[model samples]
Target: MDQIDLDLLATLEADARLSFAELAERHGLSKTPVWKRVKAMEEAGAIRGYAAQLDAAALGFGIEAFVQVTLQSDAAERFEAVVMAHPAVRRCHATTGAGDYLLHVLCRDIAMMDRLLRREIARMPGVVRTETIVSTRTVKDRHSLASAAKALGKG
Candidate 1:
């Protein structure tokens, strides 16, 4: 992608609701070209999809916790499949540490979180053990991939 494409992506990353005409005006281009560029990015899988950012806390999701999970030797696939299908799990990462997977989970309260841990999570595919760390406050939730790409000279 060129500088123009990178700029468009950065703008969209900040606010995906912006119209093509607005993006064009911001980038000093016409609507057609801007729309075409965005469409091209979408087709090429650079721009995956657009979504509305929701306030989890306002939506009654009060507790945010991170779990470091260690599974049995041959249960990675099943464990990951279950994690992917689970709704309360916001994000899951396969890591390189002693723990095999790291899970970010959201719940309505501490009791719900505890219940989820002891019931659902414990009964998942091959959960050997898990360590939970609850967040007091979210200092930072998600970062911009477009900005990171530009900073790393990958855009």
Candidate 2:
């Protein structure tokens, strides 16, 4: 992709709600070109589908926690299946560290978090142990895609 394509991605990342005409106006291009660029990016898998960013607190998920899981055996696939099936598990990553997998979980309250740990995670087939750290605050939750694009000289 060229500089114009990078600029288009950066603009869309800032606000996906911009119309083709608005994007054209901002980028000094015609609507057709703007639309074509966005479409091409989508087809090439560079531009993913968009969605609204929601507040977990407003949605009754007041507790956010990270869990470090150690497995009893090399049953990562089995454990991964269980983690993926649970809605409360927002993110999970396989890592090369003190733990086998790292999980980000959301819950309504402390009681809900406790239940999730005891009834679900602890009893999972391959789970040997888990350490959970509750998040007291979120400092930086936004993406740095624009800066990354700029660093690549695409902006």
Candidate 3:
């Protein structure tokens, strides 16, 4: 991708709802070329898909928790599959640390969080133990990767 593509990515990252006309105006280009560039990006898998960023608290999930899960040696695949299918789990990562995996979960209340920790997650396939940290507040969340790409000299 060139500078125009990088700028387009950054622009789209800020607001995916922008129309091709708006994007073209921002980039000082015409609608058709901007649309073609976006289409190319999509076809190249640079742009996978887009969705609304929902408010978890507004959706009734007030409690956000990070769970560090340790599993039996051979249960990685089964544990991942179950975690992937679990509704409460928003994201999971396999990391090198004290725990085998990190899970981001949401619940309506502390009571629900407790149940999730003690019953649901603890009972999942091959869960040996889990340690949870309930977040008091989120300071920052997800952001665009455009800056990172530029930093990596890919832009």
Off by over 4 Å in 3: none
Question: What ranking emerges by TM-score with the best candidate at the front?
Answer: 1, 3, 2
Better of 2 and 3 by TM-score: 3
Query: Cα deviation of 79 in candidate 2 (Å)?
Result: 1.0
Model 1 residue 31 lDDT score: 100
Ranking by lDDT: 1, 3, 2
**Clashing residue pairs for model 2:** none
Task: State TM-scores per candidate.
Answer: 0.95, 0.92, 0.94
Per-residue lDDT value at 105 in model 1: 96
Q: How close is candidate 2 to the true structure, as a TM-score?
A: 0.92
Per-residue lDDT over 1-155 for candidate 2, one digit per residue giving the tens place of the 0 to 100 score: 77888888888888889999999999999999999989999999988798888899999999999999999777888899888899999999998888999999999999999999999989877999899999999998987575687786764
Across 1-155, the per-residue lDDT of candidate 1 in tens digits comes to 98788889999999999999999999999999999999999999999999999998999999999999999989999999999999999999999888999999999999999999999998899999999999999788789888888898976
* lDDT of residue 97 for candidate 1: 85
lDDT (C-alpha, whole model) for all candidates: 0.93, 0.90, 0.92
Q: Which is the leading candidate under TM-score?
A: 1
Give a tens-digit lDDT track for model 3, residues 1-155.
87788889999998999999999999999999999999999999999998888999999999999999999999999999999999999999998889999999999999999889998999998899899998999898876787678768886
Q: Rate residue 122 of model 2 by lDDT.
A: 90
Among all candidates shown, the one with the greatest lDDT: 1
